[model samples]
Target: MHVFEGLEQRIQFMVLEVAKQVDETLRVLISPDEANIEKVTSRDDYIDNFKSVIENACFSRLHGQSHLDKAGIDFIRAVNIISNNLERISDFSVDIARQVQYLSDQRFLDQFEYRPFFRQILGALDIVVRALFHRDLSLALRICRAEFILDKLYKHNFDKIITRLQTGKEAQNLITTLFIFRYLERMGDSLLNIGEAVIFSVVGEKLKINQYQALRDSLDSLGVDLPLREVDFESIWGTRSGCRIGKVSGDNKGDSTGVIFKEGKHKKIFQEKINIHEWETILPGLTPKVFGFQESRGNASILLEFLTGCTFQEIVFNEDKEFFEDAFFLVQETAAMIWQKTLKAQPVPCSFIAQLSKRIEDVFVTHPEFNTPQVQFCNLMIPSTSELLEQLQQVELEVTAPFTVFIHGDYNSNNILYNQKEQRIHYIDVHRSTHGDYVQDVSVFLVSNFRLPIFDRIVRCKLNQVSLHYLHFARQFAQEYHDTTFEIRLALGLIRSFITSTRFELNEEFAGSMFIRGVYLMELVLAHQGRPWEAFRLPDRILRYRYY
Candidate 1:
């Protein structure tokens, strides 16, 4: 607390100094006084020096011997961002003052409405300390709104300058005036950053103004009376969906039933909302209940009931054998129920190759070494990455699912949750859910279990066992439904899942294993091409991690 207090005081001092710089710059702009111009320019050095002091203090508190809590670290981070932006504002003020010299006539600037720019900037700056220190969402929102006002003022003046330029008179003065307004506009940009940083400090998560508003609207829709400041937000990281997902709960931990808040592009979030509703219709309790949904200009947010359970990933790594078996059995039962209930008698071409093509570049971006070139081994031509893809594409053309089933598109282990007490299974991140070949989910589920970075022999053995068990179960389902190409189609799906998954993996050895397995599967599928598709068998060795 002492360290934070010290840093806050330093920031407050910096804010006051920067405010003085802006006020002095405004005076110089209104009535060009050589003394005032010098004051604004000279004081910039002091502001820079103060910024360095505050920055060093922040870093010291963060990396020093003293251990600080999460809130403390977030506060320090916000302070650092705020101080840096404040310094930028001061530099912009000095730049604006310098531009005043370019005005041939001081009244030349009088034609444009510049006074409101200063008024907005100064008003926003006035509340930076209070908004940040007091953790006031209202004040922070006010600060962010100032940027819009400044932008509008800048646009008006810009239009006027362009009109005056068309007259082909005083072009230089007009351009110079535009530079001053541009610098003013930049100050607004910095203020927006400062306001968001303050919000980050309060929420302890980096949320844009739009996202904050979306969250507010979503909570309001649910008739939740809690203030934004009272909501605790914990971000769920490691999500590749590009959505801002977090768990939101009220300050009263005992009484609060938390909800998952997700905000992203309007299309993605809206699609997810629709998918959730569809899933609810297919299986009543399979997906989280949507508490609220709101769409803005181009983004949307949804509030989902936070399902209480441990993910399948947790069950494998943490739970005992009995618990793991119960969870796995529930997963199998749930998969069977969903597939059987939604089975449609329609032939669907396997899209694994197409899916792989879309994401292959991303894979090479992460693991370029996996992109093999054609090579000759004992008069045998080994296909390159592209050639392998070509061969697989041709092979995939011959294999199609006999029937389609509604499936969880992204069937990763972590996406499946098992509520132990209730003995129930639930799925999350179901935006990709749709009526598709059930092999797609099977392959993803297998690779998801296999590619988990857990390297312990016992844990890996469990993962392998689970993967094999599910593979056999799926195979039996295929046989019962007279689906002949399930094995071949699943191989293609595995190849796609295995290779594309490497993009998210950084561990070279582990990623290399997955890449090799994918290539091996592709080769096997190609080797058995032109033969009865049902004869193409997926060797269990390909899925097992051999401890070498």
Candidate 2:
């Protein structure tokens, strides 16, 4: 066989070998078959070697075929990616087999009905091989679609595991099985990436096909002047939030209009609409001019004005000391400006504490991992969810505001846009915007600044200083409004937002550090329970609690 043909055949052989692993894993999953365990486990070495061989073959071909074009190189690299993903599939299969081999029982619980998934994945492998060989975009599309199906199955099985946890079933067995399911689910993701690589190779350009389709449909529905295909769609990263955000802009007769596109669940998108309209009415020009909204396929996207300016965070963190000092004052003044607008507006009829109580309930249900001390967060201790709820209830939230005020539920620096030239602030990603305690927005703003991923001691110190100034700004608003609950309620809001946030973040050091702050605030709320609300103080530094 020719060198190129040999490489292609090797890629096929690698996937087929991975198919065997998944096939054997199914037998082990259904029944503790020792031979299936042995077969899958022993082949891990071979699979690893196969990956190395395929990778080296691709590179060697590139080196030998000096006349190869970029397309030829891309084909080689795509095959390499596929081989790597297939090897991972084998590794996961071996992990599953090892779990089964160590099982003391002859039968494992099939609560997830995982046998069909094995068949599905094996089928996916077959299709992937064909797609790679022929560069068949249709087969690649099918593989991508299979990932969605696999995700649904994974969620169904994950919820089953959580339900088992609620029932107080066998912990060790359930945890191990949970890890196995995680492996299977990750295999699905790796396969998805492989399929995407196929599409990338075929298209000769990069775009998340699903989102590109959604964005195109969105611009079409809006009847925007930009041509559907020509509209540049670039994925924007949300490092701190779970929103699939993008920026789409185009030229119409040399007049370009930029719009931000955000996609998320139906409810979140719906809330964003309400919040945007609320700001439009009460605090006009304080948010981007929302162009339109669309919902379909259990997801929603919105297009709005993409304001041009640095984030308040960028201004605050800029290296110029004078700029930082000036920006610090300006940020606080802006906070005061926005807080005052809501101080007189009609509230959403939901009390902040009542809303907080519901969120605390969600925290308990979603983040039950924090229930056990063995979870090992920071050294600072936290109360059980139940106990924390009880302590939270003891605080008095009835403040003497003339009435409720519209509050930005997520007032983080990243969410708020600043135009230094225009001296205006615009809010985006306002899904959580609701009418609640001014203190709720205030507390969120404070913690949002606090939780930023900055580690420089001096920068952190300055950021904390700015946060304290912002809080003092909020307190001034509170004192003027005759609202007495700012201090304690801020603590409660921090606890609710921070502890619940643990589920979204996976970084141990960052998450653990945040957990410590949450626990510290929780303990303070419990200690000063029934005391004067103003007597408590928000900490100047998050790391200070680390010494405890």
Candidate 3:
């Protein structure tokens, strides 16, 4: 082996050593025998020294004037991240050891009678350690992937401890158990960090591959199979808010995933029949292949077959223009299909004015002082704002448009998917689909594309004339997709409404909102296009959303 090869081997050895130490510490934590805990605590310096040596070696390589190959650089980066994660895991192990020692000193360790919780933490640690050393993303995924189970385990144990503390007369030991359980949960968290590091090392990206389809592509190329075992709402990755992302197995023929049990508010309120009916009827072909839906703990989660494709945003921005025409046409076609399906499924007309009115009311109630004469009429009274709002009011959306199909509530470029080999298009991120105005989908789609500014910022494309291109393409899309009328008016109306709703609260800060800036940009373009000056001014406080 060459010198870099030798260094790579050495780094791998160090990672495995740290993983071994982690395993040892976890074992001591589970049993908490005085001799074993003391031994693990005593080895803290050795872990620290190991880390110091690796850091010096990395620095030495950087200083030695030895040029590193792509693989070497990638390896060095991976090792560095892995080394840092291991160091943190070791620190956490030491913390667990100290907590265990304290519990033993007070004779509190014996009073707490739950060993299964420790076992769960130990399992999580073991999985994480193997994941890092072997770079087994499947194992790493199982570690991140098992967060929900361990989360429930912690919660169950926590409840037991809490119940004991509340009802029992002498419960100081329960408090210690709570702390110990907390350490165990923290151990799981450290394990999650290791999993994330492994994923970053493997995929070269972070949490971008959450949707099933994206994950499938990422793993398929690696020839790895990470099956979704079960949906655990309490799993570390199974939180209700934010992104609900998890992993599943790729191999389906061998071992099927276990049934996940969820008992939560979502199950009580959500109608499975309705969800199933909606999937079957409204989105016949749109729903992802449902593996199953279950209520775990107090959260409802569903597992579906992983998708294998790329996002429209990724395709448009990343791929070369030699493929641009085909990619753009695919996006246009996909959006058209989704738009048509949306129209047929849900033909109900929602009053945007009523919605805006309620939102305005909520804002006033939240900030009662905004009702003051100076504030209420202040920005609206401004010529620019009043003039802009007046132009917007001239355009009235009749909930009466003939097309009444299901509309993707947030139809943006991000939701469109592309398959290269099949030369096919798929629409995803369909959770927010609903029945609404055709223009609502159309206008929102057009406006969303304006957000990236990728053409303007990175590629040095002239955007002043980009509107012409946008208008031209949109018209072409309308004809190609469904032969709709050619007009930027609906898109402009959506932009105007978006500006009004967002800027009302931001009135004091007019130069903040991008919508406001976009309106300003519209004005500059309209000025160039020989449109009225009144068309360009933004509604009151609407400029606030555009900080710049």
Best by TM-score: 1
lDDT string for model 3 (1-548, tens) is 26555456655665556556666665675576878777767777777777777777766776774676544455456556656665776676677667665553455555554455455445555555445454445566666634444454577667777787778754555666677667666655655665666655544446532333344344322222113322122222322222244455547566443322222245431443244346457546443456667665565555544456665556545537656557667766655665656445233433443444445433332222233232246555423433433343343232234455565555555555567767766554445555556556555554444433233344323222232344455556555544332233443445544443332232333213444453464343343344532233323222122224
Give one digit per residue, the lDDT tens place, for model 1 in 256-364: 7667776555776787788999999998988998989998987677888878888887788874879999999999999998999999999998899989999897676
Residue 242 displacement in candidate 1 (angstroms): 19
Q: Write the per-residue lDDT of candidate 2 for residues 346-430, one digit (tens) a residue.
A: 4332244455566654343324344443233598664565566565665544332344667676676666666667766677666
My TM-score estimates for the predictions, one after another, are 0.60, 0.59, 0.40
How many clashing residue pairs, candidate 1? 0
User: Could you give the C-alpha RMSD of every candidate to the true structure, in order shown?
Assistant: 15.9, 11.4, 17.9
After TM-score superposition, the amount by which residue 67's alpha carbon in candidate 2 deviates from its true location, in angstroms, is 23
User: With candidate 1 superimposed using the best TM-score fit, by how many Å does residue 217's alpha carbon deviate from the native?
Assistant: 33
Give the lowest summed-lDDT range of ten residues in model 1: 225-234
TM-score of predicted model 2? 0.59
TM-score, candidate 3, is: 0.40
Q: How close is candidate 1 to the true structure, as a TM-score?
A: 0.60
